[model samples]
Target chain A: MDLQTLTYIVVGFTFALYIGIAFWARAGTTGEFYAAGRGVHPVANGMATAADWMSAASFISMAGLIAFNGYGASVFLMGWTGGYVLLALLLAPYLRKFGKFTVPEFIGDRYYSRTARIVAVICLILASVTYVIGQMKGIGVAFSRFLETDYDTGLFIGMGIVFIYAVMGGMKGITYTQIAQYCVLIFAYTVPAVFVSLNITGNPIPQMGIGSTMADGSGTFMLDKLDQVVTDLGFKEYTTQVMGSKLNMFVYTLSLMIGTAGLPHVIIRFFTVPKVKDARSSAGWALVFIAILYTTAPAVGSMARLNLMNTIQTGEVGTVEGNIEIANVPQWMLNWEKTGLLQWEDKNGDGRIQYYNDKNAEFVAKAEAWGWKGNEMTKVDRDIMVLANPEIAKLPNWVIALVVAGGLAAALSTAAGLLLAIASSISHDLLKGVFMPDISEKNELMAGRIAMAGAIGLAGYFGLHPPDFAAGTVAIAFGLAASSIFPVLMMGIFYKKMNRAGAIWGMISGIGVTMLYVFQHKGIMFVPGTSFLGDMGPNWFLGISPNAFGAVGALVNFAVATVVSKVTAPPPDHIQHLVEDIRVPKGAGAASDH
Target chain B: MNKTAEQYWKANIRLVSILLVIWFACSFLFGIILVEPLNTIKIGGVGLGFWFAQNGSIYTFLVLIYVYTKRMNALDVEFDVHED
Candidate 1:
C-alpha cells in the first residue's frame, strides 16, 4: 500500500484504541475525575507519566537538536532526566502523602493562605498553557504532513479527539490512554532506530551502534567518521561543538531539570498512585522508560548527520564530482520539499547541490576556486532529522507510517495532560476551593469538564495561529515552572517554618524577575521589535540566555523566601505539624475531597 | 515530634544529600566542568566526558533512584512508618 493510506489506517486504529480505553475508564465522581480514585498501580502510573512527560519535543525535535548542536545539546539530555531525581527524592513522596488532588490545593492548605494558592494557580496556568501551545502546533504539523490535511483542519481534529477523551474520562481516561500511547510512541521510535543502526554499524542496538565501527569495512568508529566528515566541509566537529558558553549550558541544564520536576502535569501524576512509596518508585520506572528513548537519541542524531553528509557529498570535498547532481537527489529530499521544511536552489547557476558551511570565511576562498557560488541547500529544519530519518534511510513504508502515529501520540498525550492540569487548577483550586467552597461534588465535576473543553478550544485556536514566540515556548514554559513553582513546593515540604508571606512573595518575585529578563531579551511577551536588549550573547546577564536564567531565578526565590520568612511570623503550630505528618509515610489515607 | 520520627527524617535527608552529590558530580562535573580534561580518556570511539554527558549520567540517575527507593523502603519499615 501507499504511505498515506498506511498512515491513515494506522493512525485511525490508534485513535480507535484511545476512544475505546476512554469509554471503559469513564470517571463517575470528583475523586476519579481528579485523581483516578488513587488506585493506579505503580508501574502503570510510571508508564503514563513517561508518556505525559515526553512531549512532541522529546519525540520529534530533541534528536534533531542534538544532531545539529552536537555536544552542547547534552544540556537537554541531562537537564531533563536529572529532574526526575529531585522529583523522586525530595518532592514526590511528601506530596503523595499530603493526600490532596491538585498541586495548588497542597500549597493553599500548607501555607494557610488563599492568596498563595492563587499565585500557584497563576504559575501553573502560565507554564502549562505555554507548553500546550507547542504540542498543539506539533499535532497540526504532523497531521498536515502525514494525512495531507491543512494545518487548521488537523488542529481541529486533534482538539476534538482530546475533548472527547478528557471530558469523558478525566484523569482516569487520560491515564489509561497514555499507557497505550507510551507503547505506540516508544515502539514507533525504536524500530526505525534499530533498523538504521543495523544498516550502518551491523548492530541492532542504537546505543551501541553509534560507538561501533562502520559496517562498510571502513574500520573507523562511527563518531570518529562523523567528526571527520563534517569538519571536512568546514563545519565544527560533530562530537564536540558547544552550544554557547559553558556557563549558559550549565544554567540551561539546571533550569530544565528543575522545570521538569516543577511542571504541574508531571507532579500530579504521582497523586494517582496509592502510597508514598509507590510515588517514589513510580518516578524511577518513569525515568527508565524515558531513558530507553533518551539514550538511543544521541546515536540516531550522530548517525543521521553522517548519513546526510555522505549522501550530499558523494565523494571527497574539493573534488569535481563531490556534490550530488540535482536530478540524482534522493527521493526523501523531494518528498520533504513538498512540506516546505527542506528547500534547495541552484545557486551560482550550477545544477548540482552543494551543502556546506558557506559562512566559514576560511573556507570561502577555497570554495570559490571550486566553482561554487554558495550553498544550494537554503533551508533544512532541524525537526526533519528525526521525522524524515526513516525515509532518508530507505526504511519500509509501514515503518514510516508508524513514525507518523508515534509523533501524534507523543503530541496528544502531553497536550491532554497539560489541559487537565490547567482545568483542574481552575475547577478544583479556583472555583471549588476558593470561590465556592460549598459547591456540590456533581457541580464541581461538571465545572472541571467545562474547563477542559474550554482549554482545548483555546489551545486549538493558538495552534491555528501560533504566536511569534512559538519556537521559544519550551524555554518559556520550563523557565516559568523552574523559577516560580518548584522552589515554593520544595519549601512547603522541606522548610516547615515557611510562612504564607514568604511563599507568596517568593513566587511573585521569582516569576517576576524571570519574565522581565526574558521579555527584555526576547521582546515583551515575545512580540517582535519590543525587546530593549537585543537577544545576543554579550547583552545577556552573566552571559546566560533567557532560557538559562530560570535557575538563577530559582536561587533568588530561595534566598528571598528564606529572608522573608525570618523577618515575618513563623507558620502556626498545626501547620508545622502538618509538615511533619507529610514527612512520614504512615497514615497516608486515600486521596480525598475536602 | 517524636524522637524516632525526627531520626527517620534525618536519615532521609542524609541519604538524599549523598545521592544528590553523586548526581551533580556525574552530570555537571564530569559532563560539563571537567569535560575538557576527561576527554583525554577515551571510552571506545568517544571520549569519557562525552559519554557521561549523553549516556552515563542518565544511567546513573536511574540507578540512584532505584537505590534510594529500596533503602527508603527499608527505612520506612525500620521506623514503623510503612503504610499498612
Candidate 2:
C-alpha cells in the first residue's frame, strides 16, 4: 500500500466508475443529451452541479492560497460560494423554465437574433476553454505527483479518462458521473481537513479550527499564533489587511462572483432539473454541498500553516539548519524531496534546513549574519499540500490514494461538464441554431461527441504546455464567466424590456472587454513577454486589477443592455409569453424538451 | 386564471425583493463593508465576520432558500398552480 500505488488504484477506480456511468446513462435523444431528459432529481442534479462547479481550483489551489495569504484569502471562500444566491434567486428557475439546452440557445431565442447567439457562443467557449485549461493542467499535475508518472504521460492518461466519459455520456452521462464525483471530492476534501483540524486545534470540525485556541493555554487564537510564527520569520501577520491595495481585493472578489455566475457548466446544470422550483431548490442544495468543502478550506489552510511552521521552523529542524545534511529529514520530507517540490541547501554550512522568507530584506540580513546565503527551501508548488496532505499527516496509505482519486475526480468531473457545454454549443447552438437547421438528431449527437473529443485534445495540449498563472489561472476564468455571462443572463431572465439587440450587445461587450483586459494583464495569450500597458493598470481605469475587472465588465453589460433596450421597440408578445411561462412551472414539462 | 397569473407574478416579485435585501446585506454589506466591525465579536471561538465569511452566510442562504421554497409552495397553493 505505497502512497503512490494507492493513489493509482483510487484514481483508476474512479475513472472506471465514470466510464461505466457514462455508458449506463448514454443519452438516447437530443433532449437527454442536452438536458438529461429534464428529469434529473433536484438532489441528484444538485450534487452533480456541485461537482461541476468545484474545479481543480477549488480542490487543489484554494486552501494553499488561503494558507499562504491568511485572512485576505477568505474573500474567495465567501465571494465565490455566495454566488449561489444569484443562481438560486435570479437565474436558475427562470432559465430552467426557459428550458434551453445551452446558455447561447437562451440568448439566440430570447433576443430573436442569430448574431446575439453567436456572441453568446463565443463568450461561452472562451470562458469555458480557459477554465478547462486549468483543470486539465491540474489533472496532469495530480497524476504525475501521485502516480510518479512523467508530466506529459500523466496528462495523456488524464485526457483519456475525460475522453471516455465525456465523449460517451454527453450531459446525461456526465450528470450521473458528476454525482459520484461530488461524493469522492467532498470526502477527499473534508477528511484531511478534519484530521488537520484535530491535529492543530483539537477540533475535528474544520469550520471551528480557523479561529480555535491553541492547546498550550497560549491565550490567543491559532491564527494569532500563526501570525506571530510567520512574522517571527519575517512574514506579514496572518490577520493583517493585505499589504497590497484593498481595492485589488475588492475587485478580485467581484470578478470571482461574476465568473461564478457566467461559467457554462453550472448554468447547464440548472437546465437539467424538471421544474423552476426544482432549479431553485437545486441551487440551494448545490450551495449547501459546496459550503461543506468551502467552509473547511480556510481551516485546512490555517492548520497546515501552523503544522508546517511547527515542523520546519522550530528547534533541531531550524537550529541544525543548512540542509541538515539531507539525512536527518523525516520519511515524508524525503518522499516529497523526490518530486522536486521540496528542496534544501546548506548555505550557512549548518547541517539543518532554514525555512523563512528569503524575499524579506531584514530576514536576508539576519540569515546572512547567521552565515547563510538566504532561505534555501526551493520550489514549493502550492498543489503539493492537497496532494500530499495524507502523507504529511502520516495518515493511511489508502487516504493518500483517495486524495489522488479525489483530485482527478475534481478535475475530470469539471472537464467533462465543460466539454459537454462546448460540444452542445457547437452542435446544438452553432450548427443547428446557425449553420444547419435540418440536421437530424443522430448526426447532431455524433457531432456533439466529436466536438467533445476535439475539446479534450485542446485541453490536453494546454496541460502539456501550461501557462504561467498555473495555480490561479482557473480563478481568472471564473472571473471572466462572472463578468461576462452572468449579467446578460440575468437581464434575459428578469428584465422584460431587454431586447435582443441589448442582450447581444451587452454580452459581447462584457466578455470582450473582460478578455481584452485579462489578455493585457496575463500578456497577449499569456506569451511570456508582458509589457507595461498590461500590468494591471492604473492602466485599467481607476486602479482596478485585471482579476477584479469582471465586475466592471458585468456592470458595463448591464449598462449597455439597459440603454439599448430603453431605446428599442418592445419584444414581440410571443417572447413576452415565453417570459411569463418561464415565471412558473405550469408548462415546465412541455417546454422542458428544449 | 389571468388574475391568478397576475397575483402569482406580484407575489414572486415581493418575495424576491425581501430575499434580495437580506442577500445583499449578508454578502455585500456584512461580508464586505461592515466586516471589520463585525469581526470584533465571536461565535464559538470564530470571528463573527470570519464565520460569516465562511459558514454563517452560507447557513443563512440555506435557511433563506428553505423559507422561500415553503412560502412559494404556499403561494402556489393560493394560485392553484402548485407543480404536481
Candidate 3:
C-alpha cells in the first residue's frame, strides 16, 4: 500500500480502538467518572500516566528541539524527567492517601477553607488550559500533515474525536485509552529510532547507537561527525553548545522539573491506582516507561540531523557537487514541501540546494567566492524531523504510517488528560463542592461531561491562533503549575501550620507574580505585539527567560506563605488531623464517595 | 501525634532529604554546575558531564524513586502502618 493509504488504515484502526475502549469503559458514577472507581492496578495506572505525561511536545517536537539546539536542549530532557522524582518521593503517595477526587478538594479540606479551594481551581484551570492549547495545536498539525487536510478541518476532527470519548468515559475512559496510546506511541517512536540507529551505527539500541562509532568505518563517534558537519557550516558543536547563561539553564531546568510534578493532570493519575504503596511504585513504573522514549530521543535527534545534512550536502564543501541537485532531492523533502514546512529558493540561480549556515559572517567570504548567493533552504520547521525521519531513512511505507498514528495518539492522549483536569476543577471543585453543594451525583456526572466539552471547545479555539511558542508553550504551563499549584500542594502536605490565609496568599502571589512576569514579556494571554516590555534580555528581571521565571515565583510563594503563616492562627484541629492522617498508609481504602 | 507516627514521619523526612540531595547532585551539580570539570572525563565516547545531563541523571532518578518506594514500604511495615 502507498504511504497515505497505509497511514489512513493505521490511524483509522487506532481511533476505532480508542472509541471501543471508551464505550466499554463508560463511567457510571461520580467515583468512576472522576477517579476510574479508584480501582486501577499500579502497572496499568503507570502506563496511563506515561501516556498522560508525554504530549505532542515529547513525541513530535522534543527530538526536533534537540536536533537543532544540540547540548543546550538537554535542559528539556533533564528538567522534564527530574520532576518524576519529586512526584514519586514527595507528592504521589501522600495525595493518594488523602483519597480525594481532585487537587482542589485536598486544598479545601486540608486548609479548612472553601476560598482556598476556589483559588486552587483558578490556578489549575489557567495552567491546564495553557497546557491543553499546545496539545490541540499539535493534533491539528499532525492531522494536517498526515491526512492531507487543512489545519482547521484537522482541528475540528480532533475535537470531535476527543468529545466522543472524553464526554462519555471521563477518567475511566481516558485511562484505558491512554494505555493503548502509550503502546502505539512507544512502538512508533522506537521502531524508527531502531532503524535509524542500525543504519548509522550498526547498533539496534538508540542510546548505545548514538554513542557507538559510525558504520562507515570512519572510527569517529556519531556525535563527533555531526559536530564536524554543522561546525563546517558555522553552527555550534552538537555536544558542547550552551543554551544561555549557565544560571538560566539551571533555572529553566528547575522550573520544568517542579512544574512537571505539579501538573494537575499527572498528579491525578496516581489517584486512580489501588493503594498508597501502589501510587509510590506506580510512579517508578511510569518513569521507566517514559525513559524508553526519553533515552531514544537524543539518538533520533542526532541521527536525523546527520541524515538531513547528508541528503543536502551530497558533495564536499567548496565543491559544486557537494550540493544536491534540486531534481535529485529525496522524496521526504518534497513531501514536507507540500505542507510548506520545508522550502528552498535556489539562490545564485543554481539548480542545486545549498543547506548551510549563511547567517554566520565568518562563512560569508568563503560562500561568496563559491558563487553561492545565500543558503537556499530558507525554511525548515523543526517539528518535521521525527515525522520525516522514517522516510529519510528509506524505511517501508508501513513504518512511515505508524509514525503518523503515533503522533496523533500522543497529542490526543495528552489533550484528553489536560481537558479532564480542567473539567474536574470546574465541575467537581467549583460546581458541586462549592456552589451547588446539593447537586445529585447524577447531575455532577453530567456537569463533568459538559465541562469537558466546553474545555475541549475552548482549547480548539485557542489552538486556531496558537501563541508564538507553539512547541514550547507546555513549558509556560509548567511554569504556572510549578509556581502556583506545586508550592501549595507541597506545603499543604508537609507544613501542618500552613493555615488557610497562608495557602490562599501563597497561591495568589505565586500565580500573580509569575503571570505578570510572563505577560510583561510574552504578552497578556500571549497576544502578539501586546507585551509592554519587549522579550529581549535587557527587559528580563535577571536575564532569565519568561519561562524560567517560575522558580523565582515559587520562591516568592514559599517566602510569602511562610511569613504570612507566622502571623496567622494555626489550622483547626481536624485539619491538623487530616494532615496527620494522609501522612500514613493505614486505613486507606477506595476513595470515599462524598 | 503518637510516638510511633512521629518517628515514622521523621524517618520519611530523613529519607526524602537524603534522596533529594542525591537528586540535586546528579542533575544540578554533575549535570550543570560541575559539568566543565567533569567533562574532562569521558564515558562511552561522550563527556561524562554531558552524558550525566542527557542520560545518567534520568537513570539515577529512576533508581532513586524505586529505592524510595522499597524503603518506604519497609518503613510502613515496621511502623505497623501498612495498608490492609
Write the residue-wise lDDT of candidate 1 on A1-594 in tens digits. Answer: 998899889999998998899889988888888888899999999999999998888888788888888898899899889999999999999999998999999999999999999999999998888788778777776776785655677677778877777788788988999999999999999999999999999989998897799999989998999898998888898778987789899999999999998999999999999999999999999999999999999988888888888889999798868889999999888877876668999887777888889999888778988988888889887766777889888899999999999998998899888988998999999998899998898998888889888888877776665543232466678888999999999999899999999999999999888989988987875666788998888999889988778898888889899999999999999999999999999999987676
TM-score of each: 0.97, 0.94, 0.98
Which candidate tops DockQ? Answer: 1
Question: 1 or 2, which is superior by DockQ?
Answer: 1
Candidate 1: which stretches are off by over 4 Å? A149-153, A461-472
TM-score of chain A of 2: 0.94
For candidate 2, write residues A1-594 as lDDT tens digits.
566666667777887887888889999998888888888899998899999988888888777777788767766776677678777777887887777788988888887889988988888887788788888878877777765655677678888877877888878888998999999999988887887778777878888777788767676788778888888777777765451456666667767766777788898898888787788789888988888898788787777777776666655323444234455666767766665656777665566567788888977787676666677676667766777666767777787777778888898888888999999999999988889988999999999889889888887786665554344777667767876688878877677778988887788787778878877777776555664375744576677766667887888888988998889888998888777777776666645434
**What C-alpha lDDT does candidate 1 achieve relative to the native structure?**
0.88
**What TM-score number comes out for model 1?**
0.97
Cα distance off (Å), candidate 1, residue A261: 1.0
CA lDDT for candidate 2: 0.77
Q: For all the predictions, what are the DockQ values?
A: 0.88, 0.53, 0.83
The best-first sequence of candidates by lDDT reads: 3, 1, 2
Ranking by TM-score: 3, 1, 2
Worst 10-residue lDDT window for candidate 1 chain A reads A464-473
Tens-digit lDDT string for candidate 3 (A1-594): 788888989999999999899889988887787889988989899999999999998998889889998888888899999999999999999999999889999888888889999999999999999888888877877887886766777788888887877788788989999999999999999999999999999999998988888999999988888999998877788988887778888999999999998899999998998899999999999999999999889999989999998888886987999889998888888877876768889888878987888888889778889998888899887877898889999999999999999999998899888888888888899998999999888888788878888888888888887764345788889989999889989999999999999999998999899999999988888887899998888888768888887888888888899999999899989888989999999999878746
